[model samples]
Target: EPEVTQTPSHQVTQMGQEVILRCVPISNHLYFYWYRQILGQKVEFLVSFYNNEISEKSEIFDDQFSVERPDGSNFTLKIRSTKLEDSAMYFCASRSQTSSYEQYFGPGTRLTVT
Candidate 1:
């Protein structure tokens, strides 16, 4: 089965810098999402996308954050300005139209903001 893939397994950046995390979800999936886990915290939803538009977003997904499918295969999350609190393991997930409850997750990108 196909799986989600993410780039730059780990990233380190200074506070106030910009960072872009990339992913490639299962090609056949219709829904895409971005989630983050702050250290020992539970996973938190950031945003969801479908058909080239944002379907829903959490409060954490403020103006500083954005997501887009720049091409047929690549999905990206850009943080305009990083904050110390933004350090976490960021995951990219996707599920088919028929399975809304199950998501295939990528190997997360670990972001460290100092």
Candidate 2:
């Protein structure tokens, strides 16, 4: 079965630097989303994209963040200016249909901003 994949697994970065987290969503899936969990916090939705435009985004998705489908299989999230609070496990997910809300998550790219 096809599965979502994330790069680096873990990263440590200085505050105010740029970081790009990479993901490869499940093949043939359409709806893509990014969520983050800050240590003991709940998984918070960041953004969801489909048909090449953002479908929905939470308040947490500020100007510092952007996402893209760089190619057929690769999806990317870029943080233009990282902050210490940005430390979290960023998960990439995808679903085949809108009616099916179950999201298959990647192992995650842990961003540690210090």
Per-residue accuracy of model 2 over 1-113 as CA lDDT, tens digit each: 78999997999999999999999998889999999999999999999999888999999999999999988998899999999999999999999885466789999999999
* TM-score of candidate 2 to 2 decimals: 0.95
Which candidate leads in TM-score? 1
Which pairs clash in model 2? none
Off by over 4 Å in 1: 99-101
RMSD of 2: 1.3
| lDDT string, candidate 1, 10-46, tens digits | 9999999999999999998989999999999999999
Residue 100, candidate 2: C-alpha displacement in angstroms: 4.3
After TM-score superposition, the amount by which residue 81's alpha carbon in candidate 1 deviates from its true location, in angstroms, is: 0.6
